[model samples]
Target: MTADATKRLCDVVLDETIGRATPDVEHERAVAIFDLLEENSFAPVGHDKGPYKLALSLVDSKLVFSITGEKGEPVATHILSLTPFRRIVKDYFMICESYYEAIRSSSPSQIEAIDMGRRGVHNEGSQTLKDRLEGKIDIDFDTARRLFTLVCVLHWRG
Candidate 1:
């Protein structure tokens, strides 16, 4: 994505309808997700032996973030380990971006786009995604946004 696209994505996510609805609630959620993302608590591939560390790396070429595990890890183990958690993060960002993109490309305000996106997530089986993630990881929507923000901020600008 271009820098403009990235900024627009961020704006939609941070908009009042979806993101600014309840700052405190979002903050709490974001913190919870961040904790889960940074920890070694979740199974890498749903194994009892795992306490695999989770990491996020931005792929500008793909315009999406990669949810990865420790280096040299088995792909199956990594996939099994972090699949649910990764889905949550990926979906969250995509939802936000989709909203932003729709709004930017249309005549709607950014907030309207966010609302539409949020509704889409809710109506389009975000709960199913949540069900897959629940009990597997301790996180919520807000934390996912915060984690995304942190990743964007920490990424190299040049």
Candidate 2:
């Protein structure tokens, strides 16, 4: 993504109103994220962008998230500096754990909540991401396990 786009998304995420917004209503935020990923130009080894596969890389304090195509090629890549959000690492991990628990228990509501929370965190304008996650009243062991794995993959710094 362009510097301007990244700046915009970060601004939205840091804004006080994030807790009141939802991912579905954050078009600009989503666009900014996509723009960043596209601008970074880190396509997968042999794929495009159709299959919903995502890869993440962290190097020299930079974090990259990428989507792969049908054949396992990268179609989009998002790169960002880890310095600004380093303080939130623990929180991110905690949320991921909760998401995993929800998934493991086979609770649709928990899974949905985690999905929404994930969207809010990834989408950039939804502050409610954390709040929604905190509000989850139950846990699903199965969903939690899968979500934990996915989150771990995304947060890996190697």
Candidate 3:
């Protein structure tokens, strides 16, 4: 956890529109949220709000981040176009599938190679997220990585 409690997220909620996800995706979502809550730095720019709650959703091909105070008071809402992420997200999923298949049948070295590629793609997504959220919200790399995982979750159709 960061030293400033005010900058951390206390809770996270994905819009009901997200509906049901596959068990694997559900697990990923659960872990991402849990890890985010455990340690993250998220502060909405120009707002002195502390201990925030987040509501993430996809609406009209946009990624919406709804931030609120601990008691649910509105803080900020940042809506980003999903266009920039489309290709990268698709590439990420491809790498993930390869990594999973490698895990089941490939040799240890081969699996490691695929895993490295998967991580590289994940890092790319995280950097893209940070770039998109540049001025709207201040978050660390680790936070961006976790949030990117959630973004991938939004794209999961299963």
Candidate 4:
């Protein structure tokens, strides 16, 4: 782990509405949260340091990333509109579906190809999120990728 990632997340609270998510979505959330807690870099611009607790939710169609200090003091709230992420998220979902299906019957080479496409989409989402959170918070690529996965889980309400 990088020095920047030394201060990891101590707690996370996803919106209750997000709990009814599909098994895949729930799995994504679980894995991301687990990995994020194991290691991550989360530094909010111009704020006190963390071990932060994040409360993620959607309000008025906007995704909210609400962060607080370890003791739960309000640190910052970054609300992002889903417009810019629409294309990448849609593509990611499509590829993930195909990737999952491929795992059930496809050959190793075919599965590898689909997995590569899935990773590409995942990277796209991660980069977009990193850009969107640029000024408000500074997060490393790994953190951004995990965050993106969690965001996709929130978007999976169907």
Ranking by lDDT: 3, 4, 2, 1
Expressed as tens digits, the lDDT of each residue in 120-148 for candidate 1 is 55433434433445554433454344443
The prediction achieving the highest TM-score against the true structure is: 3
Q: What is the C-alpha lDDT of each candidate?
A: 0.39, 0.41, 0.90, 0.82
Model 4 TM-score relative to the real fold = 0.87
Q: What is the Cα-based lDDT of residue 25 in candidate 2?
A: 35
TM-score of each: 0.27, 0.31, 0.93, 0.87
Model 3, position 61, has a per-residue lDDT of 89
For residue 11, give model 1's deviation from the true position in Å.
25
| Backbone clashes in model 1, listed as residue pairs | 29-143, 30-142, 30-143, 44-81, 45-80, 45-81
Error of 4 at 37 (Å): 1.6
Error of 3 at 95 (Å): 0.7
Q: Tell me the tens digit of each residue's lDDT in model 4 across 1-158.
A: 44753255677888764456677767777887887777777878886477788888778778888898988889889898888988998999899899999999999999999999899999999999999999998888998998888777767754
Model 1 residue runs over 4 Å out of place are 1-52, 55-105, 109-115, 122-126, 144-158
Model 1 lDDT vs. the true structure? 0.39
Q: After TM-score superposition, what is the CA distance of residue 120 in candidate 1 from its true location, in Å? A: 3.1
Which candidate number maximizes lDDT? 3
